[model samples]
Target: MSSSWYRDDTAPPPPLAGEGWGEGVSTSDNPQEERTLSRIASDDAMRPPPQAGEVKTARGQMSRVLRAPLLLALALAATPAHAFIAYVSNEKSNTVSVIDTDSWTVTKTIKVGQRPRGIEFTRDGKFVMVAVGDDDTIQVIDVKTQAVMDSLPSGPDPELFAQDAAGKTLYVANENDNTVTVIDLEKRARLGDIQVGVEPEGMTISPDGKTLINTSETTNMAHFIDTTSRQIVANVLVDARPRFAEFKHDSSELWVSSEIGGTVSVIDPRKHEVIGKVTFEIPGLRKEAIQPVGIGMTRDDKTAFVALGPANRIAVVDVATRKVTKYLLVGQRVWHMAFTPDEKYLLTTNGVSNDVSVIDVAAQKVIKTIQVGELPWGITIAP
Candidate 1:
């Protein structure tokens, strides 16, 4: 009877001999098979067995290394939690007041060009641009440094400007020249000028960035300018002395406040026609008392707050119903206002009182008054 026999050797075996299995089965398979089998033959010789404590530590270290990048990625994604700052254009002082929304205090007083009226931050939040009407240019301030960086070329007496969503262009309204100066923000140069009616005050760009609306104070008309060609497309008649113009948050409607006409004209931007008019008539106050000036609307387009200059109050209107819900008593000659990002506070600049009235939006009451530079006209908060 034939029987299989086994022999164990302590020495290392030879290298593999052939690719095929049967070609060299007996002699070639032994050394090759011994080498492969020797790896696990002895528990002490297999490898230096890791200490029990070291094995657990190595596993924890490997796990952390594998998760390190994912943890770092999550930390990076959570960065850039910045607080918003509001810039108020002090017309008489020729300075810009930087207000910290978190503390509700003026963080800095930045001296700008002459007669800074309309102020806005770039869409990227890198720069704050202020329209200095008397200087006839737009002063740019770096947000990180809070310093004057440069000036954009504007037409004569640029009162206000509207920036495109890309922040690549600026449409400046020239009050003295009665024209809109188109500017290339990147190039920092004036592209061209589109002539409009008398004393254009408030300017706004359509949601699609295809059209621009320039509200003329004396002409009482909103001139729609084609953005691509930079030409006047149409003119919609509005109330007299239109001071402040705001597009609804949803970009569905446009509201133009007439200081002298004592009304707010809501217009359909597409058709360039007055779709509705909001007029105020308080019991003891005269029809002229409720002179709407600054307009602030919620991001949801649910509520609109209109500043009644001489009335010393803000008329809260429901956007859906287009009706005045309540009149909030504020400071004297409330010229303009800006809403906090959270929609909790509405700050109104009272021209005559020389202060900013902070109104609680939820309660509809003036909670505090902050003294600012003389004659604060236009205000805007940084994103």
Candidate 2:
């Protein structure tokens, strides 16, 4: 709502009110309960799908006009145009907000493990896995029913994670420990841990899935681990407090965002050398305030968007020229962003304002802001 909600970039986040997982929050083991939950999605098929360009205020009354079940079922069977579900992890609220892109509204808030962050859909799209840092594990949610069904053993304080190209292996960045935990996705077992630098926060794998990249906040280095050996092959030093790392689609460049350094290091993936840097400049904001945390690139690699944490802006960078083309004013403390499958729109999580900003990618304009849970950290859209 106001600028006062934004927290200081340099300071630690506000202390969480609750510590352990909430009561009755563990995975359900009852077969009946599981079956009942699965039927929820099926029963929802009787309701009519929201039409495109429909106003949000009128969405609630659509259920009242539901006609014959056959007609509604037919509507549900026919997929809506470019419909996708976006999941946002609210770090402080211990919940995941599910937004139906068709209506651009939050359809459900699913209760999850404590401090849920770093969420993504599995390759098969059957389930959504979210790293619950406080629980010392990753929780899995069934996509159809939107319920927490199981959990994976992650190391202590798993803040971020990256899956292999096949989605068979998962590499988790455990913030509390100086190691990345490797897990077998199919078997749902912990393979082992690869020691990295201190306070590892960013996790990403290359396009070929051979190299795993992890950035340590305290160590100020990007550790390149050979996925085959599960060992650190090389470490490239970056600026202060590197928070996030992203690779171009063609695997030519790797961009690492340094939070305190206020710059992004563009590294050559093949040579593992810093070839260039993407810097951001805001007219009235101090350098410290323009901390870059999350980065998103286009499929063609022609453009990139960097989230300026406290500056409350998204810097649009021209990839070839390496220049800031525009700065978009979004909600306060924009943390991360994800694009829809079609790339027609981009949604950003604004922590302080407790909402997600929808940006029309082609127009480069802020179109709408949808309210979500508190301290929204990360987001992932369905493929």
Which candidate has the highest TM-score of all? 2
C-alpha TM-score for every candidate: 0.77, 0.80
Model 2 scores a TM of 0.80
lDDT tens digits by residue: candidate 2, 282-324: 9888998999999999999999999999999999999998899
Off by over 4 Å in 1: 1-82
What clash pairs does model 1 have?
A: none
Tens digits of per-residue lDDT for model 1, 117-169 = 87888877767889998888999887777878788899989988898988888
Angstrom error of the Cα, residue 88, model 2: value is: 0.4
Best by lDDT: 2
Clash list (residue pairs), candidate 2? none
Q: Tally clashing residue pairs in candidate 1.
A: 0
